[model samples]
Target chain A: MPKTLEIRKLHVEIEGREIIKGVDLTVSTGEIHAIMGPNGSGKSTLSYSILGHPDYAVTQGEVLFDGENVLDMKPDERAAKGLFLAFQYPVEVPGVTLASFLRTAVNSIRKKQARWGGQPLKEISAIEFYKRLEEKMNLLQMDPSFAQRYLNEGFSGGEKKRAEILQMAMLGPSIAILDETDSGLDIDALRIVSDGVNALYGPDVGLLVITHYQRILRYVQPQFVHVLVDGRIALSGGPELAEQLEEHGYDWVKDQLGESAVTRQNG
Target chain B: MANALNFNRREGYLEKYGFHDKNSYVYRTEKGVSSRIVEEISGLKGEPEWMRNFRLRSYGIFEKKSMPGWGADLSGLRFDDLYYYVKPSDKKGRNWDEVPEKVKLTFERLGIPEAERKYLAGVEAQYDSESVYSSLKGIWEKLGVIFCSTDEALKKYPDIVRQYFGTVIPPGDNKFAALNSAVWSGGSFIYVPAGVKVEIPLQAYFRINAESAGQFERTLIIAEPGSFVHYVEGCTAPVYSTNSLHSAVVEIVVKEGARVRYTSIQNWSDNVYNLVTKRAFAYKDATMEWLDGNLGSKVTMKYPSIYLMEKGARGEVLSIAYAGNGQHQDAGGKAVHIAPYTSSRIVSKSISKGTGRSSYRGLVHVRKGAHHVKSKVRCDALLLDDRARSDTYPVMEINEDEVDIGHEATVSKVGDEQLFYLTSRGLTEEEATAVIVSGFIEPIVKQLPMEYAIELNRLIELEMEGSVG
Candidate 1:
């Protein structure tokens, strides 16, 4: 059976404020879902809540990835379970290099992949890992010198986003979330980044592409599109919904469900 | 080695070299610090009128000052019994071959003169109370730079000493500073001329081969306008049954548009009271950097400070300390901005293992006249086991509104999984913890010179031995 991520009525809270309230999401292989939202609409919160960031408390829901309870797993364990979230503003870890960090994360995912197989993967050699990394860098037009530099230390916005996709490519996660990957990129950088995402969109990997614009979706086509207003998915439909919503704007949904009423009902 | 073993069974490691044996030396002081001992120390060093009067005035200040209650415990320090001075054999050795066999063996054990011959651009090796050998290479002297003991500077550059000494940090600044001024001996005196940058670092190694004796060294470094230099100070005291005292003072004056980097790696015997005062003054467009490492001491109270006195000046202090059983490492940094547009940063990393305690007490003060000054302070402490403890106390007094300041502190231990992961990769428990500790201290290690960084790693490994099963 093809592995899938089923989020059945998941609600998340930090302190007392609800961020992801009753969010129902299903992501399957060979499909890319584009989630568009206004600012402070809890779009990033949902990504963090799913990846098991310690701050977000899962109030009353079950996130089932391959039929396993994901809330009970640690962050690294969730990462090991083929779940990757490319942070919007990637943190700079001073002493940890991209190559060393990727080596550890890749080997961790390899260990997870070995349990169900008849034979172990015998941990990829350093040379093999370097070869794959070099190839992925070329696809994204990323400088190979970045692999030795400290992770995201003094990188520009476009460079950081490219590095994030590079990680997704090297680790080969089953389900990956790219949060605001096109926030601060120029038109040329936007095309290069979309191509990198398109190259990785295959039957083996499912993607949740989160952004606030409809421009990136034009390049990397999504099979499903959802508009997040407040904390709930107020409008969800096929790929055409993105173009409609982008043209007509989010007020139509806000008016259909009264402004404060829909906000309180979902927020 | 025979004389070492036969010297005294009670004194550990560097047994025979200690000055505690009453009959071991000639022309020593009686019990306490009165006018008599002060005069004895001065008269023994061969009296000059101005130097004698300077020590007398400092002795009065040391008497009036009381012990500070802030940092390390000073209750165990027996000021009356500590031998103020030991000649360490009669005369200073003019050459390497002339040094006495006992003192020579002590340097051999420490690998001192050999290290100087290889890596250091210049060297000063101080044994007990005086500089036994100081042969700075000709490359430095040819540049019109002064690299010699404080005593030499006192005689050769008296006017230079009179103009700058106690100007940045006077004798009355603190208790330890007053004590150091009273009986200071055998430390570096450097003066780099304007616009002359020294590529190779100058270094001094102070080894206390004598027991129960106080070695009070004073280091003074002055970089003229637009010049640069890096000075390193290292200390290691031989173990003893009774405690010894090492109260040194280091004062640096970086002139306008100059820079000076001072690095220290301290590994004293657990019975020694490692109390020292260090301060630097940076003028307009100048910079000062301090890289301090504290490994062994019963009670150490040191905070290397910088006073930014002009606009566009910079200061940085990078320190790492490892405290094991029966030790307390109370150290931090202080930066005071007296002018506008000055900036500073303090990054301290400490590891407390096996009932040891490490605390980071620091301050970033900006005066009202100092506007638009920016500073950031980050302190990280790693406690190894249940018995260890760590604390961070940061105080920032910002009088100006146009400034940026950030402070962060993290306290973590060796996670079970981080250790398990390493051991599963075919390393032993010791090797795994060694790697983690090395990684923990990587930020500071990367800033050190190549040879010193490797030596520090090996030293940390040696300290970790027998710490775990």
Candidate 2:
């Protein structure tokens, strides 16, 4: 069976205040879905909830990954189960070289995969890991020195975004959530990152691109588009909906949906 | 991930280096300290009259000086209830085969013999308060280098031992120094002739097997002009119901254009009070470096110091301390620049977890008329959890013009975001915490030699095991 992520009636609250209110969605392997929303529309909160971030309390939700409830799992467990989230703002882990961190992360997931049953996975050798890392880094057009630098520390905005993509490529998750990955990229970096994602895209992976604008959609073309408003998806359509929103902005969707659909922060 | 346990203080320390062998002491002194006891210790060594009198005078100093009033709490330390001396064997072994079976096995378990065979130029294995094994490679001996126990030095090279015994750190320096001076035994005594350079490091392994006993080892090293030497020491004690005391004094003299580096990895059992005084005097154009690592002990108050006595001298100290639950690591380094054109640097890193506390207490002094002197001190601390605590107390006494001094301190907690980031990449919380901790101490760990650095990293991983609940 193809891998699937089914989020049903998910109600997430951050510090007792509801952020993602009763959201429902299903994403399957080989599908590309775009979650477009304005600021404070709960786009980030929705992604965090799916990843089981401790601060995002799931008051009522069932995030099932291939028939297994993911809401009860820890973040690492979720990652081990082939769920990867690329943060908008990557954290700086000082003194840990990016190469070592990637190796550790890869080995951790490999161990879990072995326990989860299939072919018994052996940890990747240093030479093999480095060869793959260098290949992926080259595809992303990143400097070779990037592997030796501390993870995300002293990295530029564009470098941090590229690092997120690099990790997504190396982890090879079944379902990858890109949270505002296009926010901090320049025109050149944006194309390189989109190409890198496209290279990793295949029938074995599902892509969930959560963003505020449709700029990345122009390059990576999501087949399904859902406009989230006031912590709910008020509009669901095909790729044309994203183009229409980009041409007229989110105000068009809010006006068409009605006054109730306007963002609470704006109210 | 759900089954991960929280950091247990005693388990980590007890699981590593806490296994003790049956005590096979040939002679052990009665509990507590007295003038008569000091005399008895000196008499047992069959030392010269001057040395015996020196012990007597140091005993008077110890009796007069009170306990230290600052730093880690010592009220629980019962000096009167401690065995001031415990002799493991009557004679020191010149080879591993000559050492007692149990003692040799302990050293073998600690990897002392293998390490010596592979890289070290000399080796000393101190069991309890006596040196059980001492050896120096024939190549170094042919170069007029003397490497032996302090007792053997007192017998063979009495003139050199007497000349530099208490020169750098005297008996009146502190109460612990006074006590160690009065009852010192079983420490390495090294002397390198002028123009000689011992390429490999000399290592000493100290083991405390007797419960509630004191191990006062006096180490003295003298590097003649144009010579170089590096001495490394490691210590561990067995777990006991009552507390043990480890008070040692290490002094060194680096002569003109000479250099000396001393590295100490102190991992005493939590039931031991590790109070040590280490100091070195660097002469013109000489260099002295101290690399100190403290991981275990109930309360440790040690500040390795370097005093630049002439122009062009330099000093450097890199120390790392890890405090687990119910432990207090009060460690740092001191640099006193008393001559022109001298330079010094001190870097300290500390980690505290689960009600553990680590304090960086250091001093950098540039005396008057010591112009063109430079000094820098940096301390960085990482708290593994909310219950852990860290503090920095830096003192800079710059009384000279045209001098440079810099100090930097940072206290950071293992942030939730950092943990979340690593966990999101498939690392468990425990593994993530250990990764961050290893990174935090990378600066100091990188400076250590290969074997020590690997051992330190492994020990840190052991301490970080089950750190997350």
Candidate 3:
């Protein structure tokens, strides 16, 4: 059986206002899907709802991960089921070294896996963990000193993106939703981060890359692209759709959809 | 299921160390204080005529002084309901095996002996009103270091003890200091000779095992010229329905080219009032540091102070406090610069959960003639819930035109974004909160010894459990 993440008729609200209005999507192992949209299109809200953020209320939705209803699970429980979300703007937790944070997250997930009758994930020794971390850092072109710095504290924009990719690579999730991972990166950083994400591609994992630009799609190809307009997917097509949107811009899509696709941005 | 997360189980984490036995003490004094009681205590100890007069004067001051009008609420404190003195054993023991069985069992449960064997150069275990077991390593003794109880030091090294006692912190400085001086009992006395350095830390453990008891331990430390020493003290007590009182006075002297570091961790029961006065006097080219951690108590009001009396002297205070339900930790630091080229730094961190309140009350003073002086003070507080409270009261008095002073403070709540970020990385809410809190205090926690740092982390984790939404 293949691992899958299915979001069915998802409706999310924040503070009594609906943000994600009846969106439907499904991602399976070995597939790459991209949700392309402009600002205020509810792309970030959909990702946050899938990850079970406390601020986002799922009024009517069912997120299934590996055939289990993940909407009823806590964020950590959902994460343990191999569902990862790469935040657009990662938080800065001072005094917690990146190495220590990664070790704790890995051990927590491993502990849950052991409870479900798989191989017991013994605690990783410090030396072994450091060896693995060094290898991942090298692949991402991150300096070794980054491992000892506080998690995302005072990190440059490019370093934060690379650190997120580094975490995704080390965690090896079954399905990952990258929410605007290329938002604040320059050309050099974009290529390094795109390459890091591509290097982690395998048949055992699935990827969902959400973005507003076609710039990163050039380096990391996506098989399918969906244009999210007004809290719904207005159009879905092959990789050529992203190229069309890049040339014509999201205004063309809104014009084509006409009065039915008026986007509303709320604070 | 929101109710499941808000179960209010703060007491379970601390209940393990709150067991008490009612009839364990050998002798107990009547409730309340008077000149007669002070005279009786001094006469019982066979103290010198000067010391006896000093006690009488302190008693008079304690009676005349009024209760403090600021800080934590002391309306519930009933002086007439507390036993002013309680002796748990007949005499101080030279060896652990010679201590009374009941007192020995308490220290065993607290793991004093095991800690002493592993990392300490000397150990003193005090129960109730006096030191029950005291020992110093032979190597430090061979180097002419004096490590003993305050009472023993008064009897054997009277010249040195009399020279430094009450010099740094006078009894009339505060109401609690006067009370502690009048009824002071077993505390550590340390002396490091000139040009000598003691590598390992000397440890002292204080326990209050009797109900409605008052424990007043007076500690004095003298670091001679060109010497260095580090002293650590830890306190705990059993739970009681009625409140107990703990008022200690600690004075330290640092001579020219000398250095001294004093570290204290207080985890009293919920029914104990911890009001302490600690001060140090540093001469020319001397340095002093105080690392204080307050974790448990009903109410605590302590602000460790340092007086720079000569040029090129330095002082530092790094303090942390945690206040849970029905607890108040009003603690901070004070630095007084009286001479030229003196410097100081104060860093305070506090956390409040449930209905607890944590306050930072501090002072930084630079006298008129203190030229080229520098000082910095920083205070940070974290409120875990809406009901929890925190406050910062900082006073800086600089009369010198050439002096530099800087102060910064921040109050922050646990952000939803930070929690979501950590939980999305596979950590439970409790675990995520613990990680954030430990990270918040890591700057000061990292400065502690390895064992103490580990214990502090564990304590924070326990405090974070069942504290999540």
Candidate 4:
């Protein structure tokens, strides 16, 4: 059976304000989906809620991973269950080297897998772990020095995004939600990050590329595109939907959904 | 989910250093302190007349002085209930084999013998209130280096002991110092001759096993002109329902152009009150460094001090204090510059979790004629939860105009975003908090030796277990 993430009628709130109102989505392995929306359309809220962020409250929803409810799980448990979310802004964890952090995450996931009933796997040795990390960094076109540098501390915007991609490559998640990974990247960086993401896409992994523009989709094309407006998906179509949104901007979706439906109180 | 920050369980410490051996001492003075008790202790050691008189005088001063009014609360300290002196053995063991079976087994459990074999140049294992075992490399001894217990030094090197004993920190310096002066025993007494550099660190391990015991060990290090030495000390005690007292006085004399580094990793059990006084004097062109790491103790009030007594002297202090669950660590460093062209740096890092509290109490003083002096003080604290607390009280007394001084302090609670980020990468909550804390203190940890650095990080991880709800 394929790995599946089923988000059904997910009503999410942040500090008592409804952001994701009755949104329903499902993603499975080997498929690509893009969630596009304007600033307050609840695109980020949806991604955070799916990953079990504490600040994002799911008021009335059931997030099922492979048919099991995941809303009650901690963020770490969600990650252990093969879910990954690339943040819009990766936090700087000073003094913890990138290589050490990635190794720890890898070992933790490995231990969780052993507990969840696969072959009882041993932890990756430092030498072997570093060798694999170097390979991933090389594929991402990242500087090898980054392995010794503190995680995202004083890193450039493009470097941070590439590090997020590197982490995804190392974790080998079944489902990865890239939240605005292309937001702060330059054209060259977007190409490298897109190439890294494209490499990770295969029959064993799923990609949910959340972006505001079609620039990243131009390189790493998604099979499905959903235009989110006012905490709800207003349109779902092929990859051309993203091209239409970029060509006409989010106003076209708002116009299609009607002014009253798209006009939120803050907006 | 609402209460994310909860108290940390200390069963790790209880398993690691909380086991007590049976009290098998050769002798112990009656409980409480008096001039007669002090005289009895000195007579037991068979000290010279002047030294016995010094102990009596110190007892008088300890009687006159009062408990410290500032820093962590010391009202819980019951001096009258504590045994003033405990002799674990009649004489010091010259080797590990000569040490009593029970005492040697305790040090073996603590890994003291293995450490001495691997990297230490000398080892002093003090059980209860006496030195049970001592060993120094023959190479160091051939270079006129003397590494022995303070009691042995008073007998073999009486002239040198009388010259420098209490010279740096006098008997009447403070209440705890006065008490240590009166009932001090079993601490390291080291001497390095001129131009000799004992490359490897000399280590001392102090252990307190008896209940309501007062272990007052006095350590004195004299680095002759152009000589260098690094001395490391570690301490632990068994957990008891009633509290114990560990008040030590350490004084170092760095002569002209000499350098000395003293590193102490104090891990007394939570039932111990670790109030210690440590000070040093750096002569012309000399250097002194104090690395103090405190991870255990119910209440600790220690501020290692350094006095730049001559031109071109330098001093540096790097301290780490971890306060977890009912522990209060009041630790920092002080630098007094009385000579020109002196420089000093003090960096303090602390972590507080549960109901624990940590405070950085420091002072930097530059006298009127001490021109061209420089100093810097940086204190950083990490609180794992809202209930944990940290305080910084820095004093700067600069009467000299031609001096450069700087002080910086930062207090940060482990942010929810940071924790979530680490957890999102698959680390558990406790592991995430430990990672953040280890990162916070990495600067000071990096300054320690390889083995010590690893041990410190491991100790921090143990303390961080079950810190989050």
Fnat of every candidate, listed in order: 0.03, 0.81, 0.80, 0.76
lDDT of 3 by residue, B1-469 (tens): 1232232334542344333334545676777888888888887778998888888899888888999989899988888888777765533223444434544443443444454321111112433222332334566788898877787788999999888888787788888999888988878889999999988887664222221123888899999999999998773323232337888999999999999999987777687889999999999999999999998788999999999999999999999999988899999999999999999999999999888899999999999999999999999999888899999999999999998899999998888999999999888888888888888999998988777777677666655567768
lDDT of 2 by residue, A1-267 (tens): 589999999898999999888888999989999999999999999988788788889998689999999988999999999999999999998888999999999998988888888667799999999999999999999989989998999999999999999999999999999999999788999999999999998899999999998999999889899999999888889999999999999988879876554555478
Question: Looking at model 4 chain A, which ten-residue stretch has the lowest summed lDDT?
Answer: A257-266
Candidate 2 chain B, poorest ten consecutive residues by summed lDDT: B117-126
Residue B388 of model 1: what lDDT? 88
Give the docking tier of candidate 1: incorrect
**Higher-scoring candidate on DockQ, 1 or 4:** 4
**Candidate 1 per-residue C-alpha lDDT over A1-267 given as tens digits, one digit per residue, 9 for 90 to 100:** 567888888888988899888889999877799899889889988988787765688998889899999888766567767788887877665555778667766765666556546456668799999999999999999889889887677899999999889988887778989899999999999999999999998998899999998989999889899988889998889999889878877877677568768679889
Give the TM-score, chain B only, in order for the candidates.
0.86, 0.87, 0.87, 0.87
The local lDDT score (0 to 100) that residue B407 gets in candidate 1 is 92
Query: In terms of TM-score, how similar is model 1 to the real structure?
Result: 0.61
User: Would candidate 4 be rated incorrect, acceptable, medium or high by CAPRI criteria?
Assistant: medium
* Distance from true location, Cα of B131 in model 4, Å: 18
Q: Give the TM-score of candidate 3.
A: 0.90
**Candidate 2 global CA lDDT score:** 0.84
State the DockQ of every prediction: 0.04, 0.76, 0.77, 0.77
Model 4 regions more than 4 Å off: A118-121, A259-267, B1-18, B90-136, B205-214, B235-243
List RMSD in Å for every model shown.
Answer: 10.9, 5.0, 5.3, 5.2
CAPRI category for model 3: medium
Give me the displacement of residue B427 in model 1, in angstroms.
Answer: 1.9
